[model samples]
Target: STSSPSSSSTSVETPVETLKSYLSELLNNHNAKRALHGVSDLVWDEEVYQYAKSFADAYSCPADGMLSHSDGSYGENLAAGFSSAASVVDAWYEEIQYYNFNNPGFSMATGHFTQLVWASTDKLGCAYKDCNTIYGRYVVCNYSPPGNVIGHFAANV
Candidate 1:
Protein backbone atom coordinates (compact mmCIF):
# COMPACT_ATOMS: atom_id res chain seq x y z
CA SER A 1 0.00 0.00 0.00
CA THR A 2 1.22 3.51 -0.87
CA SER A 3 0.16 6.80 0.77
CA SER A 4 0.66 10.26 -0.61
CA PRO A 5 1.53 13.24 1.61
CA SER A 6 -1.18 15.30 -0.03
CA SER A 7 -3.79 12.73 0.78
CA SER A 8 -2.78 12.64 4.43
CA SER A 9 -2.80 16.40 4.75
CA THR A 10 -6.13 16.74 3.05
CA SER A 11 -7.69 14.19 5.35
CA VAL A 12 -6.79 16.24 8.41
CA GLU A 13 -8.31 19.67 8.92
CA THR A 14 -6.80 22.44 11.02
CA PRO A 15 -8.50 23.91 14.04
CA VAL A 16 -8.99 27.21 12.24
CA GLU A 17 -10.79 25.44 9.43
CA THR A 18 -12.91 23.54 11.89
CA LEU A 19 -13.79 26.67 13.80
CA LYS A 20 -14.61 28.49 10.57
CA SER A 21 -16.91 25.72 9.49
CA TYR A 22 -18.74 25.66 12.80
CA LEU A 23 -19.11 29.43 13.14
CA SER A 24 -20.20 30.05 9.56
CA GLU A 25 -22.83 27.34 9.75
CA LEU A 26 -23.96 28.68 13.08
CA LEU A 27 -24.49 32.16 11.64
CA ASN A 28 -26.19 30.81 8.54
CA ASN A 29 -28.69 28.72 10.45
CA HIS A 30 -29.44 31.30 13.12
CA ASN A 31 -29.72 34.19 10.67
CA ALA A 32 -32.01 32.25 8.35
CA LYS A 33 -34.49 31.71 11.17
CA ARG A 34 -34.12 35.26 12.43
CA ALA A 35 -34.76 36.64 8.96
CA LEU A 36 -38.24 35.15 8.95
CA HIS A 37 -39.08 37.33 11.92
CA GLY A 38 -37.37 40.48 10.56
CA VAL A 39 -34.73 40.33 13.25
CA SER A 40 -31.23 41.63 12.56
CA ASP A 41 -28.44 39.23 11.73
CA LEU A 42 -26.14 38.30 14.60
CA VAL A 43 -22.50 39.32 14.84
CA TRP A 44 -19.85 37.24 16.59
CA ASP A 45 -18.68 38.36 20.00
CA GLU A 46 -15.31 37.32 21.41
CA GLU A 47 -16.50 37.41 24.99
CA VAL A 48 -19.44 35.23 24.22
CA TYR A 49 -17.36 32.85 22.15
CA GLN A 50 -14.88 32.44 24.99
CA TYR A 51 -17.71 31.85 27.38
CA ALA A 52 -19.11 29.08 25.23
CA LYS A 53 -15.71 27.52 24.60
CA SER A 54 -14.88 27.53 28.27
CA PHE A 55 -18.15 25.88 29.10
CA ALA A 56 -17.72 23.27 26.41
CA ASP A 57 -14.21 22.55 27.63
CA ALA A 58 -15.24 22.18 31.25
CA TYR A 59 -18.56 20.43 30.69
CA SER A 60 -19.01 17.04 32.28
CA CYS A 61 -21.75 15.18 30.46
CA PRO A 62 -23.98 13.98 33.24
CA ALA A 63 -25.24 10.39 33.45
CA ASP A 64 -28.78 11.33 32.42
CA GLY A 65 -27.71 12.82 29.05
CA MET A 66 -29.01 16.10 30.41
CA LEU A 67 -27.22 19.33 29.43
CA SER A 68 -26.75 22.35 31.64
CA HIS A 69 -27.28 26.07 31.09
CA SER A 70 -24.87 28.94 31.65
CA ASP A 71 -25.09 31.72 34.20
CA GLY A 72 -28.03 34.00 33.31
CA SER A 73 -25.62 36.46 31.74
CA TYR A 74 -26.32 35.40 28.15
CA GLY A 75 -29.19 33.58 26.54
CA GLU A 76 -27.90 30.07 25.86
CA ASN A 77 -29.04 27.00 23.97
CA LEU A 78 -27.16 23.74 24.37
CA ALA A 79 -27.15 20.30 22.79
CA ALA A 80 -25.09 17.22 23.50
CA GLY A 81 -24.31 14.37 21.05
CA PHE A 82 -24.75 16.62 18.03
CA SER A 83 -21.62 16.89 15.87
CA SER A 84 -22.04 19.38 13.08
CA ALA A 85 -23.15 22.95 13.70
CA ALA A 86 -26.18 22.44 11.46
CA SER A 87 -27.33 19.41 13.41
CA VAL A 88 -26.91 21.18 16.72
CA VAL A 89 -28.87 24.18 15.51
CA ASP A 90 -31.45 21.90 13.94
CA ALA A 91 -31.96 20.05 17.20
CA TRP A 92 -32.60 23.34 18.94
CA TYR A 93 -34.77 24.79 16.20
CA GLU A 94 -36.87 21.64 16.27
CA GLU A 95 -38.39 23.05 19.42
CA ILE A 96 -40.51 25.23 17.16
CA GLN A 97 -42.98 22.38 16.94
CA TYR A 98 -44.15 23.12 20.48
CA TYR A 99 -44.22 26.88 20.10
CA ASN A 100 -47.58 28.61 20.42
CA PHE A 101 -47.66 31.87 18.51
CA ASN A 102 -51.09 32.66 19.91
CA ASN A 103 -49.99 32.46 23.49
CA PRO A 104 -46.60 34.04 22.61
CA GLY A 105 -45.12 33.12 25.97
CA PHE A 106 -42.10 31.24 27.18
CA SER A 107 -42.32 27.48 27.23
CA MET A 108 -39.44 25.25 28.31
CA ALA A 109 -40.07 23.17 25.23
CA THR A 110 -39.71 26.11 22.84
CA GLY A 111 -37.05 28.11 24.60
CA HIS A 112 -34.35 27.13 22.13
CA PHE A 113 -36.28 28.28 19.06
CA THR A 114 -37.31 31.55 20.65
CA GLN A 115 -33.74 32.26 21.71
CA LEU A 116 -32.49 31.43 18.21
CA VAL A 117 -34.71 34.10 16.68
CA TRP A 118 -34.88 36.67 19.42
CA ALA A 119 -35.17 40.07 17.73
CA SER A 120 -33.15 42.12 20.17
CA THR A 121 -30.56 39.46 20.90
CA ASP A 122 -28.11 40.45 18.17
CA LYS A 123 -24.78 39.14 19.34
CA LEU A 124 -23.83 35.47 18.89
CA GLY A 125 -20.96 33.30 20.00
CA CYS A 126 -20.79 29.52 19.80
CA ALA A 127 -18.52 26.57 20.45
CA TYR A 128 -18.64 22.84 19.67
CA LYS A 129 -16.53 20.04 21.07
CA ASP A 130 -15.97 16.37 20.37
CA CYS A 131 -15.85 15.03 23.88
CA ASN A 132 -15.24 11.78 25.71
CA THR A 133 -18.68 10.58 26.60
CA ILE A 134 -21.66 8.64 25.33
CA TYR A 135 -23.08 12.00 24.30
CA GLY A 136 -20.26 12.57 21.76
CA ARG A 137 -20.08 16.30 20.95
CA TYR A 138 -21.53 19.33 22.71
CA VAL A 139 -22.64 22.71 21.41
CA VAL A 140 -23.08 25.98 23.24
CA CYS A 141 -24.50 29.12 21.64
CA ASN A 142 -24.66 32.31 23.68
CA TYR A 143 -26.89 35.22 22.75
CA SER A 144 -26.37 38.65 24.23
CA PRO A 145 -29.27 40.62 25.64
CA PRO A 146 -30.63 37.13 26.29
CA GLY A 147 -34.10 36.08 25.20
CA ASN A 148 -36.99 34.21 26.84
CA VAL A 149 -37.72 36.89 29.37
CA ILE A 150 -41.13 36.24 30.93
CA GLY A 151 -42.79 39.54 30.12
CA HIS A 152 -40.73 40.28 27.02
CA PHE A 153 -41.14 37.08 25.02
CA ALA A 154 -44.20 38.48 23.25
CA ALA A 155 -42.18 41.27 21.64
CA ASN A 156 -38.65 39.86 21.58
CA VAL A 157 -39.23 36.37 20.30
Candidate 2:
Protein backbone atom coordinates (compact mmCIF):
# COMPACT_ATOMS: atom_id res chain seq x y z
CA SER A 1 0.00 0.00 0.00
CA THR A 2 1.00 3.60 -0.55
CA SER A 3 2.17 5.72 2.36
CA SER A 4 2.06 9.11 0.69
CA PRO A 5 -0.73 10.74 2.66
CA SER A 6 -2.38 13.96 1.46
CA SER A 7 -4.62 16.64 2.94
CA SER A 8 -6.75 19.67 1.97
CA SER A 9 -9.45 22.22 2.97
CA THR A 10 -7.26 25.00 4.35
CA SER A 11 -6.24 28.33 2.82
CA VAL A 12 -2.54 27.58 3.11
CA GLU A 13 -2.67 23.88 2.34
CA THR A 14 -5.07 23.51 -0.56
CA PRO A 15 -6.97 25.27 -3.28
CA VAL A 16 -10.20 27.13 -2.61
CA GLU A 17 -11.90 24.68 -4.91
CA THR A 18 -10.95 21.78 -2.65
CA LEU A 19 -12.37 23.62 0.32
CA LYS A 20 -15.56 24.39 -1.53
CA SER A 21 -15.99 20.80 -2.67
CA TYR A 22 -15.86 19.35 0.83
CA LEU A 23 -17.88 22.24 2.24
CA SER A 24 -20.66 21.44 -0.18
CA GLU A 25 -20.46 17.66 0.24
CA LEU A 26 -20.37 17.62 4.03
CA LEU A 27 -23.04 20.32 4.37
CA ASN A 28 -25.41 18.76 1.88
CA ASN A 29 -25.38 15.40 3.63
CA HIS A 30 -25.50 16.87 7.14
CA ASN A 31 -28.27 19.40 6.41
CA ALA A 32 -30.41 16.86 4.60
CA LYS A 33 -30.57 14.73 7.72
CA ARG A 34 -30.85 17.70 10.07
CA ALA A 35 -33.74 19.05 8.00
CA LEU A 36 -35.61 15.77 8.15
CA HIS A 37 -35.30 15.99 11.95
CA GLY A 38 -36.51 19.65 12.12
CA VAL A 39 -33.24 21.44 12.76
CA SER A 40 -31.82 24.41 10.92
CA ASP A 41 -29.11 23.80 8.38
CA LEU A 42 -25.44 24.24 9.28
CA VAL A 43 -23.09 26.71 7.62
CA TRP A 44 -19.45 26.19 6.84
CA ASP A 45 -16.87 28.07 8.86
CA GLU A 46 -13.20 28.34 7.87
CA GLU A 47 -12.03 28.48 11.45
CA VAL A 48 -13.90 25.31 12.25
CA TYR A 49 -12.43 23.69 9.16
CA GLN A 50 -8.98 24.64 10.38
CA TYR A 51 -9.73 23.07 13.72
CA ALA A 52 -10.55 19.78 12.04
CA LYS A 53 -7.55 19.99 9.76
CA SER A 54 -5.22 20.54 12.67
CA PHE A 55 -6.41 17.43 14.42
CA ALA A 56 -6.33 15.28 11.30
CA ASP A 57 -2.81 16.44 10.58
CA ALA A 58 -1.37 16.23 14.07
CA TYR A 59 -2.65 12.79 14.98
CA SER A 60 -3.08 10.89 11.67
CA CYS A 61 -3.46 7.11 11.38
CA PRO A 62 -1.21 5.03 13.63
CA ALA A 63 0.08 1.51 13.35
CA ASP A 64 -2.45 0.28 15.87
CA GLY A 65 -5.33 1.39 13.63
CA MET A 66 -7.13 3.16 16.43
CA LEU A 67 -8.71 6.63 16.28
CA SER A 68 -8.09 9.43 18.78
CA HIS A 69 -9.87 12.70 19.37
CA SER A 70 -8.70 16.18 20.30
CA ASP A 71 -10.56 17.12 23.45
CA GLY A 72 -11.09 20.79 22.81
CA SER A 73 -13.98 23.09 23.59
CA TYR A 74 -15.70 22.30 20.29
CA GLY A 75 -17.81 19.27 19.54
CA GLU A 76 -16.34 16.69 17.17
CA ASN A 77 -17.34 13.63 15.18
CA LEU A 78 -14.66 11.23 13.99
CA ALA A 79 -14.99 8.55 11.33
CA ALA A 80 -12.89 6.29 9.19
CA GLY A 81 -12.68 3.50 6.56
CA PHE A 82 -15.14 5.14 4.20
CA SER A 83 -13.88 6.35 0.85
CA SER A 84 -16.27 9.23 0.16
CA ALA A 85 -17.26 12.38 1.99
CA ALA A 86 -20.97 11.66 1.81
CA SER A 87 -20.40 8.13 3.03
CA VAL A 88 -18.65 9.46 6.10
CA VAL A 89 -21.60 11.70 6.87
CA ASP A 90 -23.99 8.83 6.32
CA ALA A 91 -22.07 6.63 8.72
CA TRP A 92 -22.31 9.30 11.36
CA TYR A 93 -26.00 9.86 10.70
CA GLU A 94 -26.59 6.12 10.78
CA GLU A 95 -26.17 6.30 14.54
CA ILE A 96 -29.65 7.77 14.72
CA GLN A 97 -30.94 4.24 15.20
CA TYR A 98 -29.40 4.14 18.64
CA TYR A 99 -30.62 7.56 19.76
CA ASN A 100 -33.61 7.38 22.04
CA PHE A 101 -35.83 10.37 21.43
CA ASN A 102 -37.87 9.20 24.39
CA ASN A 103 -34.94 9.36 26.78
CA PRO A 104 -32.90 12.01 24.90
CA GLY A 105 -29.36 12.17 26.25
CA PHE A 106 -25.71 11.53 25.57
CA SER A 107 -24.61 8.06 24.55
CA MET A 108 -21.33 6.70 23.23
CA ALA A 109 -23.04 4.93 20.37
CA THR A 110 -25.26 7.87 19.45
CA GLY A 111 -23.09 10.90 20.11
CA HIS A 112 -21.97 11.10 16.48
CA PHE A 113 -25.53 11.13 15.24
CA THR A 114 -26.63 13.57 17.92
CA GLN A 115 -23.73 15.85 17.13
CA LEU A 116 -24.47 15.65 13.41
CA VAL A 117 -28.08 16.68 13.82
CA TRP A 118 -27.66 18.80 16.91
CA ALA A 119 -30.04 21.77 16.60
CA SER A 120 -27.97 24.60 18.07
CA THR A 121 -24.83 23.68 16.20
CA ASP A 122 -24.96 26.11 13.31
CA LYS A 123 -21.38 26.06 12.09
CA LEU A 124 -19.33 23.11 10.82
CA GLY A 125 -15.97 22.40 9.18
CA CYS A 126 -14.43 19.09 8.29
CA ALA A 127 -11.11 17.62 7.07
CA TYR A 128 -9.67 14.23 6.27
CA LYS A 129 -6.41 12.49 5.52
CA ASP A 130 -5.69 9.80 2.95
CA CYS A 131 -3.44 8.08 5.39
CA ASN A 132 -1.52 5.06 4.18
CA THR A 133 -1.23 3.84 7.73
CA ILE A 134 -2.99 0.76 8.96
CA TYR A 135 -6.14 2.77 9.44
CA GLY A 136 -5.99 4.05 5.83
CA ARG A 137 -8.20 7.18 6.14
CA TYR A 138 -10.15 9.21 8.66
CA VAL A 139 -12.50 12.19 8.71
CA VAL A 140 -12.91 14.83 11.38
CA CYS A 141 -15.68 17.36 11.79
CA ASN A 142 -15.66 20.19 14.30
CA TYR A 143 -18.78 22.01 15.38
CA SER A 144 -19.14 25.45 16.84
CA PRO A 145 -21.24 26.07 19.90
CA PRO A 146 -20.64 22.35 20.31
CA GLY A 147 -23.45 20.00 21.26
CA ASN A 148 -23.76 16.86 23.47
CA VAL A 149 -23.70 18.79 26.71
CA ILE A 150 -24.92 16.76 29.68
CA GLY A 151 -28.65 17.17 30.33
CA HIS A 152 -29.05 19.14 27.07
CA PHE A 153 -29.14 16.38 24.45
CA ALA A 154 -32.87 16.19 24.98
CA ALA A 155 -33.21 19.74 23.70
CA ASN A 156 -30.21 20.13 21.41
CA VAL A 157 -30.12 16.81 19.55
Candidate 3:
Protein backbone atom coordinates (compact mmCIF):
# COMPACT_ATOMS: atom_id res chain seq x y z
CA SER A 1 0.00 0.00 0.00
CA THR A 2 1.15 3.53 -0.63
CA SER A 3 2.51 5.00 2.58
CA SER A 4 0.78 8.32 2.11
CA PRO A 5 -2.91 8.02 2.95
CA SER A 6 -5.27 9.55 0.43
CA SER A 7 -6.75 12.89 1.35
CA SER A 8 -10.32 12.57 2.60
CA SER A 9 -11.41 15.86 1.05
CA THR A 10 -10.85 14.48 -2.42
CA SER A 11 -12.92 11.35 -1.68
CA VAL A 12 -15.67 13.11 0.25
CA GLU A 13 -16.66 15.64 -2.38
CA THR A 14 -17.76 13.17 -5.07
CA PRO A 15 -20.25 11.31 -2.87
CA VAL A 16 -21.78 14.57 -1.78
CA GLU A 17 -22.24 15.46 -5.40
CA THR A 18 -23.43 11.98 -6.39
CA LEU A 19 -26.05 12.03 -3.65
CA LYS A 20 -27.15 15.57 -4.36
CA SER A 21 -27.41 15.02 -8.08
CA TYR A 22 -29.26 11.75 -7.66
CA LEU A 23 -31.78 13.28 -5.26
CA SER A 24 -32.21 16.35 -7.38
CA GLU A 25 -33.00 14.06 -10.28
CA LEU A 26 -35.44 11.96 -8.28
CA LEU A 27 -37.26 14.97 -6.87
CA ASN A 28 -38.00 16.15 -10.38
CA ASN A 29 -40.68 13.46 -10.52
CA HIS A 30 -43.15 15.39 -8.36
CA ASN A 31 -46.04 12.93 -8.12
CA ALA A 32 -46.40 11.86 -4.52
CA LYS A 33 -46.30 8.14 -3.80
CA ARG A 34 -48.30 6.53 -1.02
CA ALA A 35 -46.44 6.44 2.27
CA LEU A 36 -48.04 3.16 3.28
CA HIS A 37 -49.16 -0.02 1.60
CA GLY A 38 -52.79 -0.38 0.49
CA VAL A 39 -53.25 3.24 1.50
CA SER A 40 -54.17 4.00 -2.09
CA ASP A 41 -52.15 6.20 -4.38
CA LEU A 42 -55.10 8.59 -4.20
CA VAL A 43 -54.32 9.16 -0.51
CA TRP A 44 -50.80 10.40 -1.35
CA ASP A 45 -50.26 13.66 0.44
CA GLU A 46 -48.63 16.38 -1.59
CA GLU A 47 -47.75 18.46 1.44
CA VAL A 48 -46.07 15.58 3.27
CA TYR A 49 -44.05 14.38 0.28
CA GLN A 50 -42.96 17.87 -0.63
CA TYR A 51 -42.05 18.57 2.97
CA ALA A 52 -39.72 15.55 3.06
CA LYS A 53 -38.33 16.37 -0.34
CA SER A 54 -37.57 19.93 0.68
CA PHE A 55 -35.94 18.70 3.86
CA ALA A 56 -33.60 16.56 1.78
CA ASP A 57 -32.90 19.44 -0.53
CA ALA A 58 -32.13 22.09 2.08
CA TYR A 59 -30.07 19.81 4.31
CA SER A 60 -26.29 20.01 4.09
CA CYS A 61 -24.33 17.70 1.82
CA PRO A 62 -22.09 14.58 2.27
CA ALA A 63 -22.46 14.23 6.02
CA ASP A 64 -26.21 14.61 6.43
CA GLY A 65 -27.18 13.68 2.90
CA MET A 66 -26.17 10.03 3.37
CA LEU A 67 -28.11 9.82 6.63
CA SER A 68 -31.35 10.73 4.86
CA HIS A 69 -31.03 7.60 2.74
CA SER A 70 -30.02 5.38 5.62
CA ASP A 71 -33.18 3.38 6.01
CA GLY A 72 -33.81 2.32 2.46
CA SER A 73 -32.39 -0.82 0.84
CA TYR A 74 -29.65 0.69 -1.28
CA GLY A 75 -28.69 -2.45 -3.15
CA GLU A 76 -25.23 -3.99 -2.65
CA ASN A 77 -22.68 -2.02 -4.68
CA LEU A 78 -23.96 1.47 -3.91
CA ALA A 79 -24.28 0.72 -0.22
CA ALA A 80 -20.72 -0.57 -0.11
CA GLY A 81 -19.41 2.55 -1.80
CA PHE A 82 -21.29 4.80 0.58
CA SER A 83 -20.02 2.91 3.61
CA SER A 84 -16.38 3.08 2.51
CA ALA A 85 -16.41 6.78 1.62
CA ALA A 86 -18.14 7.79 4.84
CA SER A 87 -15.69 5.81 6.96
CA VAL A 88 -12.75 7.54 5.31
CA VAL A 89 -14.21 11.03 5.74
CA ASP A 90 -15.21 10.47 9.36
CA ALA A 91 -11.72 9.25 10.19
CA TRP A 92 -10.16 12.22 8.47
CA TYR A 93 -12.28 14.64 10.48
CA GLU A 94 -11.17 13.13 13.79
CA GLU A 95 -7.51 12.91 12.82
CA ILE A 96 -7.56 16.58 11.85
CA GLN A 97 -9.06 17.43 15.23
CA TYR A 98 -6.39 15.51 17.16
CA TYR A 99 -3.59 17.00 15.09
CA ASN A 100 -4.93 20.52 15.48
CA PHE A 101 -5.60 20.26 19.21
CA ASN A 102 -2.19 18.79 19.94
CA ASN A 103 -0.28 21.10 17.62
CA PRO A 104 -2.18 24.22 18.59
CA GLY A 105 0.52 26.79 17.73
CA PHE A 106 1.52 25.16 14.47
CA SER A 107 -1.73 23.62 13.19
CA MET A 108 -5.23 24.91 12.55
CA ALA A 109 -8.13 22.95 11.17
CA THR A 110 -10.90 24.51 9.10
CA GLY A 111 -13.91 23.12 7.21
CA HIS A 112 -16.61 21.82 9.49
CA PHE A 113 -19.12 19.09 8.83
CA THR A 114 -22.71 20.28 9.24
CA GLN A 115 -24.85 19.11 12.13
CA LEU A 116 -27.88 17.31 10.78
CA VAL A 117 -28.97 13.69 10.99
CA TRP A 118 -31.87 12.25 9.05
CA ALA A 119 -32.60 8.50 9.00
CA SER A 120 -35.77 7.29 7.36
CA THR A 121 -37.44 3.93 7.96
CA ASP A 122 -40.76 2.16 7.51
CA LYS A 123 -41.89 3.21 10.99
CA LEU A 124 -40.23 6.61 10.79
CA GLY A 125 -40.43 8.54 7.58
CA CYS A 126 -37.42 10.66 8.42
CA ALA A 127 -35.76 10.72 11.82
CA TYR A 128 -33.56 13.77 12.34
CA LYS A 129 -30.68 14.13 14.74
CA ASP A 130 -27.49 16.19 15.04
CA CYS A 131 -23.94 14.98 14.79
CA ASN A 132 -22.11 17.87 16.41
CA THR A 133 -18.95 17.91 18.42
CA ILE A 134 -18.08 20.48 21.06
CA TYR A 135 -14.40 20.03 20.28
CA GLY A 136 -14.66 18.43 16.85
CA ARG A 137 -17.55 17.49 14.49
CA TYR A 138 -19.72 14.59 13.32
CA VAL A 139 -21.58 13.49 10.22
CA VAL A 140 -25.08 12.15 10.70
CA CYS A 141 -24.77 8.43 9.98
CA ASN A 142 -27.38 5.79 9.46
CA TYR A 143 -27.08 3.13 12.12
CA SER A 144 -26.51 -0.13 10.27
CA PRO A 145 -24.40 -3.09 11.39
CA PRO A 146 -21.33 -3.34 9.15
CA GLY A 147 -21.71 0.22 7.92
CA ASN A 148 -21.99 1.57 11.42
CA VAL A 149 -19.06 -0.58 12.47
CA ILE A 150 -16.88 1.28 9.99
CA GLY A 151 -18.00 4.56 11.57
CA HIS A 152 -17.47 3.38 15.14
CA PHE A 153 -13.99 2.10 14.45
CA ALA A 154 -13.02 5.29 12.67
CA ALA A 155 -14.09 7.34 15.69
CA ASN A 156 -12.41 5.03 18.17
CA VAL A 157 -9.19 4.65 16.22
Kindly list the per-residue Cα lDDT of model 3 for residues 1-157, writing each as its tens digit: 5454343221222355665544333222111221211221121234333444344334443543343333333100111122333442343244334443232222223211111110121111111112221211212222111122222322321
- Arrange candidates, best TM-score first: 2, 1, 3
lDDT value, residue 67 of candidate 1: 82
**Candidate 1 residues 126-156, lDDT tens each?**
8876654667667789999898888887898
Q: RMSD in Å for candidate 2, one decimal?
A: 4.7
Candidates' RMSD to native: 6.1, 4.7, 18.2
Instruction: Kindly report which residue stretches of model 3 are placed more than 4 angstroms away from their true locations once superposed.
Output: 1-39, 63-65, 68-157
Put down candidate 2 lDDT per residue, 102-134, tens digits, no spaces: 999988999899999889999998887756654
Which pairs of residues collide in candidate 3?
Answer: none
**Which wins on lDDT, candidate 1 or candidate 2?**
2
- Give the C-alpha miss distance for residue 122 in model 3, angstroms: 14
Worst 10 residues of 2 by lDDT: 3-12
Query: Candidate 1, which segments miss by more than 4 Å at Cα?
Result: 1-14, 62-64
Model 1 is weakest, by summed lDDT over 10 consecutive residues, at 5-14
